[model samples]
Target: MNKEETFIKDLVVLTPDVFEDARGYFFEGYNKNKFSALGIAIDFVQDNQSFSQRGTLRGLHYQNPPYAQTKLVRVLQGEIMDVAVDLRKDSPTYGQHFGIKLTAENKKQLLVPQGFAHGFSVLSETAVVLYKCDQFYNKASEGGIRFDDPTLNIDWGMELKKAIVSEKDLVLPDFANCNSEF
Candidate 1:
């Protein structure tokens, strides 16, 4: 795996080496030893998956401290514009965000550390995202910022008016008003 650092501290993009043949291809999506060698030693306890259609947007979400999660996210099928925002109050990149295109073709994965908010927008006809989390979900600890928060000024690569967002996510607080405990 090749690790590349994003502008935000501790956030990384990992590209795995793929071996392809006429019939198929192979890659080690995750190997404990390889990941540990790359300095990512989190013991993920849960795996989550989601399927969405094009223009479907989700997040700018994070879990509160004590239940905060570190996620390793990738696309299993189709494509998406994945985003992560640093919520660490003292971090240099606090409030800043990073966006990248993740697709089955590229096999790129985003490593979002605990002190960050994450979200993604499906860009293909259909998309299946799979992610591993270091911590389990806690409804009481769930938190989120609006996907189109003015303060963040993220370009979702599509028109907001056409984006299909959940009612809960649609009402999330803007960046400045969010209670980012991280």
Candidate 2:
């Protein structure tokens, strides 16, 4: 596996070594020892998965303290434009965001540490995204910023008019208005 740092501190992109044969391909998605050797030592307690159609946008979401999570996210099927925004109060890259394309073909994963908000836009006909979280979910701690926040200027790689978002996400506060405690 290879780990590449993003512009935002603590946010990394991981490329796993894949083995392919005439029948198919395989790769170790996660191995505690290997990950620890790479400087990631979180004890992920939950796994989550979601499926969305093209143009669907989900997030800019994060959990507040006591429930803040570090996520290792990847596309299990199809493709998406994944994004993460640094919300760490004292980090140099705070308020900055990074976006990358993750696809089943490329098999790349994004490691989003705590103190960052994350979201993704489906780019294929249908996409299946899977992620492991270091902490459990807490409804009271849930928070989000609008995907189209002007200050963040995130490009979801799709026309705004074509994007489909949940009502909750549609009403999320913009970056400047968010009360991020991270």
Candidate 3:
């Protein structure tokens, strides 16, 4: 696998070496030693998957410190515009965000370290996303920032007015008002 660092510290994109032939293709999605060599050494304890139709926007979500998670996110069956925002208080890039296109064809994964919020918007008719989290989810620690926060100004690859967002997400706090503990 190859690791590409984003402008934000500790955020990286991983592309695996894919072997293909007339039959099909193969790639090692995860290998502990290979990942460790790349500086990703999280002991992922949970795997989560979500399916969303085009125009659906899911995040800017994270867990507070003491329950913060490091996530390895990838698209399983379609395409999505993945985003991550730095929330680490002491980092120079705190509050900055990074976006990337992840598709089944590209086979690229984003490694979002703890102290960041993560989310995605489906770009295909339908998309299946799989993510590994280093920490078990704690409902009490759940937190989020509004996806359309003016300060963050994320380009979710779609228009917010027409995007399919949940009622819960619709009321999430803006970046500055968010109680981030990372």
Cα-based lDDT at residue 52, candidate 3: 94
Q: Against the true structure, candidate 3 has what lDDT?
A: 0.94
Alpha-carbon local distance difference test for all models: 0.95, 0.94, 0.94
Q: Write the per-residue lDDT of candidate 1 for residues 1-182, one digit (tens) a residue.
A: 99999877799999999999998999998888999999989899999999999999999899998999999999999999999999999998888999999999999999999999999999999999999999999999999999989889999887889999999998999999988787
Off by over 4 Å in 1: none
For model 2, how many clashes? 0
Each prediction's RMSD to truth: 0.6, 0.7, 0.7
In the range 29-119, model 2's lDDT, one tens digit per residue, is: 9999999999989899999999999999999899999899999999999999999999998999889889999999999999999999999
The TM-score values for the models, in the order shown, are 0.98, 0.98, 0.98
Q: Candidate 1, after superposition: displacement of residue 17 in Å?
A: 1.0
Point out where model 3 deviates above 4 Å. none
Q: Provide the lDDT at 81 for model 3.
A: 98
